[model samples]
Target: MTLASGLTLTVVLALVSVVALVMRPRGTSTVDFYLAGQRVGVATNAWAICGDYFSAASFLGVAAAVYATGLDGAWYAVGFAAGFVPVLLFVAAPLRRFGEFSIPDFLGRRLGSERVRLVAVGVVQLVILSYLVPQTVGSGITWELLVGQGVAGLSPYATGIVVSTAVVAALVSFGGMRGTTWTQAVQFLLLLGALLWLAATVIGEGFHYGDAVEQISTAPLGNPAPDGGLATEPNALHPGEPAVFGEPGARYDVLGQIALMVTLAMGTAGLPHVMNRYFTSPTGSAARTTTVWVLCLAGVFYAVAVMLGTAAREIVPGAVADNPWLDELTVDGVLTVPEHALPVLGRIYGGDAGLGVVAAGALIAVLSTIAGLLLAAAASWGHDVYERHLNPRATQRQAVRAGRITTLVTAGTAAGIGLVLRPEAFAASTPSIVATMVTWAFAVAGSALTPVFLLSIWWRRTTAAGAVAGMTTGVVVVIAMLTAGTVADGSPWPDLLLAPTLLAAPLTTVVTVVVSRSTAPPPDVERSWLIMHGTAADRHTQALARLVLAESRRRRREVRRARR
Candidate 1:
């Protein structure tokens, strides 16, 4: 059965590669490679946006978090869905309108400073790498479960990390953004379809969502003990009390709540991979429209994810108890590995095929995200750094080659880091390490880039120095606090430092405001402001008038020639 599932995974990866090959850029220009020549339409870009945004964290991590923490875990989903709101209202259209190949490129040109561009490239790479590692971890987890074997003494998890990274790196190098965009859009449908089918099947099997929540609520959430044999442990949200499912505070404190939401919501706007896709839209208005569609699909995806998590809370334990082989995976009523909740439920309901579909969706989530991340990395390194600084006179082919090489290097680095982390070793009853790691990336991006990004767009006073200061403050505070929290042993510091956006974001904002007041604005501020905020309709009208005037001039020239 595992072999059969592995075969399914192979076929899916091959198909995606073929799709990338078909959509591969026909030209060698950076525009063609980085932005798909800015030709993608609204609907396709929306799906690709979903594929980019809904990584392993959203697909498997969210459900697993909910399974472990009850309604408290659903905060991840809520934060994720709510994140798109800020993107739509603030960043999407204007970002595309002021578009470049990547965020670093935009900030560099906007600020009129090469230093600002270089600094942004460093931050964007950090954000991308932070985001990429979790997807690789997720692929390994899915592979370990579905394949149940490894090659040449390597762990199945390690094999998965290598294979998934290699495949996506090839796709980005071969297909570039155009190929990756098409594949991502299609893969997202596969992801959404898989989630919907499983959710529907379980509910139809007399699994009451309300009852599942109520039953779990009556007892404190207890997860399988870390010792891994037969012991079980209680994961109480309140030290001595059972946590309820339909409410807040089960997984977060008030500070945690505010920090998580702010980080997730604002973080969406600053995600390098996510924002890079906006440049692919054919028009600024199309980018805005694409975000609306993303919001719709994301709402559906996460809502179904929450329901499936609740279903797992009811189903997997019972199913495991009836089967001897499941003992290693679950102890008593608790799952040893909370991340397996979705796949375990798939097997329980629709048998092997269900398991394969669900498992493949997990890999697809990883693949789609890795493709976008790799592309973002390429843009940052190749366009933002290499082309901008090292090779101003380089040819299109040379730039594309540089980007491909960067993609491979970035993919390898992420895979190497992921293997080192071995995320499975630290899994627990609470939001698993994979989910928590993702929040770190979001927190840093939000605290550092989001505030400065938004201020640069809306405020006329924002300067290059301010942008750099804000981002630097954010990066330093987030990394320092998260490191201290990880090493420290305590309640208040860990909780607050773990989700530090509440503290770090304000600090970043202050630095940005103070620095901007002291520094002068970019010299092209008036023109840049017009470009960023001009109505899409105005551009459309202007383009149409230009075309009409050109045609009229051509007609007059023909008449004069005929008269002569």
Candidate 2:
């Protein structure tokens, strides 16, 4: 790592911290602290939502996966972008219209049961921590590349986690949702700008995307793996021979491919952080618009990430002899870890300064994700558990205080977990370790929360008891399946156990519907539907009414001033 790169990362993080603090919400209400006072606009919220979704998985992991697996990795980008379609078509409007503080809050109130809230809280926390750990781990990995040393004799990885976790925790505590929203929006743009810059530079160097794909796929997908690195097997995409980058089965079988796509696509509907962002929208229609914008912005971002990965496959090996850094990371022109794919490109293309910019982008992605996760955790605990159940008479100030405390605790716990789950612990065998962990979270969310959530909105027969049973069934079944898979890591049934969402989600839906049939429905289904399915004209007219009220208030103030 170069001093120039280290300084750039430090300066950039400091700026983000300052800006978020400046945007910190003044009101101490639950809405102010947790959902940005429900006042965020479409464009800004859309960008923030993109930043929340991207994580280190999209910014770093996707590229590395593509570099390592050829065409198989492109599916990850597709799965991620496609996930939002379900959110837009099914969940976004109703969720925003029936706005609550968090997922647990929504579920609890929708079902009129504190028990449902408590159960949902547990699942939400599980998902958040599952999501948070990977972001924290990604921070350490990026730091290891950007700055090789640790502060005060700590390991490079540990130092990275501690510093990043501390800074992000502080920001979440100080700024709340309002601060996080602004910071995330800015972070996403910066990340996009970095990708665009690198893409432009590569294209100017006469790099052809098609040529790179053909060249890499022409043989089997291969990269430099030093003595300490994990060994590559025969290409899965190709089966018996070296796999081409354009072929299927490069990394997974046909079933595995379908499973992966289902896990990721349905995952968005249940992600606590992403759904919470919708609650910040001014109206349901605004939330729908925001989802549309997210799809557009995210498409451009992931497309560039995929291209960078392909280009890096060709760029890095040739630079090995010329760049000393390559010697440290590569063996026989192959990268030690696929995660090094993007950062190494930055150094080759623009030296330390370029490497610094990309590294900072990686860190920014991690930070933005951690912020969203921490806030989601806070909302789950403070609004759903504490305010609603523990302290029914609590003031807004008290509620905000509880949320701030929870955010700190959640952030710290995730950092500690991240420190324990070091890459070395995993033997650095999988370069895309962060993505793998994130996929677990997605699987859990899609299975446990999403199916039940959609049912509650669209099927009025969904009862509190059915929701509880369905959610519990989903969580328990998916966890059991994932655990079984982990134990049988090298076994033949790997793909099925590894990504059980395709089975888990359908099972959850079945269990929910069956239980609902036996349980009593809510007495006021039409009332809930009326609130959720309000038309665009209704939304527009409501907005006009609010505007009129504000104008009349302003006129009255002016008349009072004239009389004085």
lDDT of each: 0.86, 0.86
Deviation from native of the Cα of residue 239 in model 2, angstroms: 4.3
User: What are the models' TM-scores?
Assistant: 0.93, 0.93
Over the stretch 83-128, how does candidate 1's per-residue lDDT look in tens digits?
Answer: 9898999899888898788888888888888998998888888999
Q: Can you tell me which runs of candidate 1 are displaced by over 4 Å?
A: 1-3, 228-247, 536-564
Q: How large an RMSD does model 2 have?
A: 6.0
Tens digit of per-residue lDDT, candidate 2, span 1-564 = 577897889888888888798999998888889988899999999999988999999988899878777778888889989999999999999999998988888888888788889999999999999999989988998899889889998888888899988899989989999999999999999988888999999999989999888777666555444445434545554567765566766677788789989999988899999999999999888999999999999899999999998898888878887898788777667766667778888889889999999889898999999999989998998888888889999999888889889989998889889988765444233437777788889999999999999999998899898999999999998899888877765776566677789999999999999998998977767667667886777756767887999999999999999999
Clashing residue pairs, backbone N/CA/C < 3 A, model 1: none
How does residue 287 of candidate 2 score in lDDT? 96
Clashes of each: 0, 5
Cα-lDDT of candidate 1: 0.86
